[model samples]
Target: MERFSNITEALMNEAKIEIESFDIKDGEKIIAYFSEIPSISGFPYKIILVENSDGIVYARFRQWDTEYDFTRWDNGVYNLDRLRIITDEKILSQTESALLKEYLSQLEKIHLPENINKENVIILDSSLWKFGFILKNKNIDYTWKAATEDINVFVPLINLMREKYLDRI
Candidate 1:
């Protein structure tokens, strides 16, 4: 099988961006872990990558967070991502279920050692955290509001596939 991580690292490095990986030894900077999130969870690593003729580039990594998908803002609005869930892990056989549960419980919170966020970024007045990798909670501010309502979305056969995304992380 193709080593999932090697491919991810290659892509990120080629883009002149470093996705977080096991090889980093500098005490696991949060930014390092910031890249290649899904892969870090023993799942696929996906990035919102936009490459163009010019060298400038920007990327966002996906991660699993155990919380709600939407939040309210100081502006009295909500913020969220309308995900089209593609696969469900909950449909696994009974035997598979047992193993998956055990596997998820063993994962670490931070694969690296350094502080996850930069010094200046601070969450606001509310207490709700992000659903996955999203930084700002909409409850504190409407800055991260979803662009559109969900359309043509599919649910995974497994009920906890979404939860697995959080537990695995």
Candidate 2:
């Protein structure tokens, strides 16, 4: 086995990740992707976005907190459709509705452009009541849940992206 020096190296080595190409008009930025994920068994899910500020890579996704008032896409544009609460799923009880409200509120905190297309929105909430898959270290947030991070999944993907896109190798 080629022992990697760190988590980033491992993911890039394992996944061999690659990024799809897209057009950008000079200063125009792309909204990589935002997804609300629910666990496989369906207890928890989370809102996450893979972001790249020109050359700098970062993830703006996080666990929703009451204090957060949806609004930050530092250097790139966000798909506005995500800002709204997803009502497609049927809420089983009032408590579920309340939980959905919380999730929607969190989604609102992410500032989005008015003309964002709905087709570009990718919301993958299973039960629609819970979300996970975000890890925070100081001010930087990564798109991995506590469980996922325990096994070291975040850095590898980061490394993979860097290797494929930035050619950090």
TM-score for candidate 2? 0.19
TM-score of each: 0.18, 0.19
Query: In lDDT terms, which candidate is top?
Result: 2
lDDT per residue, candidate 2, 37-123, as tens digits? 333222121222232344332223222211121234333333232222211111123443343335434444654232222344455
lDDT of 2: 0.28
**Backbone clash count for every predicted candidate, in the order shown:** 6, 12
After best superposition, candidate 2 residue 39: deviation in angstroms? 11
Error of 2 at 103 (Å): 29
Note each model's CA RMSD in angstroms: 21.3, 20.8
The Cα local distance difference test for each model comes to: 0.26, 0.28
